[model samples]
Target: MNEINNILYITGAGVSEESGIPTFRGKDGFWKIGSKNYTPQEMATRRMYKENPEQFLSWYYKRFAAYRNHGPNKVHHWLANKNLITQNIDGLDGKAGNQNYIAIHGRLDQMTLFHTQGDNVATQQAPWDSVDETSLTESLLEVFKISLSTRKPMKSQSFKPYVLLFDEYYTELYRISEAQQRMIDADKIIFMGTSFSVNITQMALEIAVTQNKPIEVVDPYPVRIPYENTTYHRMKASEYIERAD
Candidate 1:
């Protein structure tokens, strides 16, 4: 039997595609909101969030709603025991009871205070959860109005979804140093459901290639595998995991 002790599994949006959640980058990903000129990328930035909190909240809330009902699939369950690193923010891995994983991108279920000073604080859940979405929106708007009326900027701001924006640095919250070390230490590396489009994926791939580690790539679509010791499986994440087991 092949020893899977030093295995490292790096996953992306493709892992959760089998579930109801949609990928947020490709053709199947979040495009533009209705009648909005800005793309999802533009909306999901610190600048946009600061300039127009209402619009930012609207888009973010929609994203949270979309991924709320979906649970982890076979891939997540199988990889729960493996050393996994995920770029997804849906939190399905956590829901599946997979603790041996790192979420490079922050999860949606968490909230953070929009502190004016340095370092925004993160909370397990939203500060005010008793109110429904509509009521929440209205309350935020009222707070904004109050701030404007009293000319007190402090009253306007509250919490924002704890997700990594496009412009944000991964090292801010993610265990990037630890993740990179894991990539370098892995004897066998597996790439699943990723397109090799993100920076972190590229970094991991380069590490594996430079060290001549054996690699297995699982994706239904054609993905670029630059390493010589790589075996590509043109299958979905769940199918590949099941077959390998």
Candidate 2:
């Protein structure tokens, strides 16, 4: 039996940040006092968008801008081949050449939505990440109300960032279904960089921890998962792969 046929992997922002992407929270990663500290849940929820379209759009656009020109780093490229799963929106894990992974948080490399009115809007960027500067222009940029007098920013695909924002249920349920099956089917799960923020992480951790799957977590500053006999390596994703390679 292929020991890893049932192998499941999950990742979080810590892994993506290694590739030069900016995360909502940094290791030393928070805006200082007096600055707006929008909780990830608050800023990333569907309710925020419904109540404040302008703010949501503006914040998302700026947030999306951080990923331009970045490519998957060594860790992402390596783990992509491990029958992986990730919560990152950066799309780097798959682009890094991991063939069997899914982006649980949704992908920034594509944009989409299923409107209540039955409108399904979507745009795909192939051979590159949807976060690529060109993808934004070709797909999503026009929704912004900008003037032609000054050069306008390229549009992201017309749909949202393809991410699962708060108040959004469809993608969340879909991702959870797949992940649950993966967890149930797998004998081992290697979790890297996820902060247990969403239901996905929480659920997977609950299952894996309960099942006593051999799990490993890798990070420069690894958290202490309060479980007996789980291994944690304190190192950057790149460093881990370099040694493993």
Candidate 3:
């Protein structure tokens, strides 16, 4: 461990699984909405939010509220000492006091008022801290002055979840360049709880493969996509961390 510096941990929803926050692609997946059959990609789009702000906000806020009660697990705490690039929006890493990490996918605990210019864009809040559904609905109605039937914004003034929606590009992400550079610079790349299905994981893995660096993956199952020079540990993320000695 002493020889390791510039550590890059490419993390996914599995890291937070021990904390009782479900993985995004698990059986009860992010897109596993009820009978509506709307996928997470559909629900988390800007268009969905615009078409029916109330319904969109309700879905997002409810999920955010569920995440609020869960604190980070041991794996998150262990990762605090490393340079992390996480695909999770649950904000567990931040809650674990891992300030050195980059949340490439955005975070649920934070939000910003969109359409604000310059310095005003920085005004952010933990939606669960002060946002109430009733007040949010009232505010959307007041700000947009849209008819109930149409549900379209007359004038656009809205709060944006500090996350990358399905339609959003990595350019819209915060610190994406920094995250990429860290991935490139790291001599050691460790992956935890990722299924290799998302773009971020693909990017990280590609860099590792190109660099010919050794890869350590901690997951109970085999990695979804195999890579050369990778050592796999068959255990949950927290278990792997605890047994790292």
Spell out the clash pairs found in candidate 1. Answer: none
Residues 1-245, model 1: lDDT tens digits: 67767989999988998887777556667643421666887888877667776666666766554566589998888888888899888888988888868888777667566543236454466433443566655554343332434432242255656677787776635677889999998988898988787888889988988898888888888486756788899999878867787
RMSD of candidate 1 to true structure, Å: 3.4
lDDT per model vs. reference: 0.73, 0.62, 0.73
| Lowest lDDT block of 10, candidate 2 | 27-36
**lDDT score at residue 227, model 2, on the 0-100 scale:** 74
lDDT of 3 at 229: 83
Q: In model 1, which regions exceed 4 Å deviation?
A: 1-4, 31-35, 115-122, 127-131, 139-157
With a 3 Å backbone cut-off (N, CA, C), the pairs that clash in candidate 3 are none
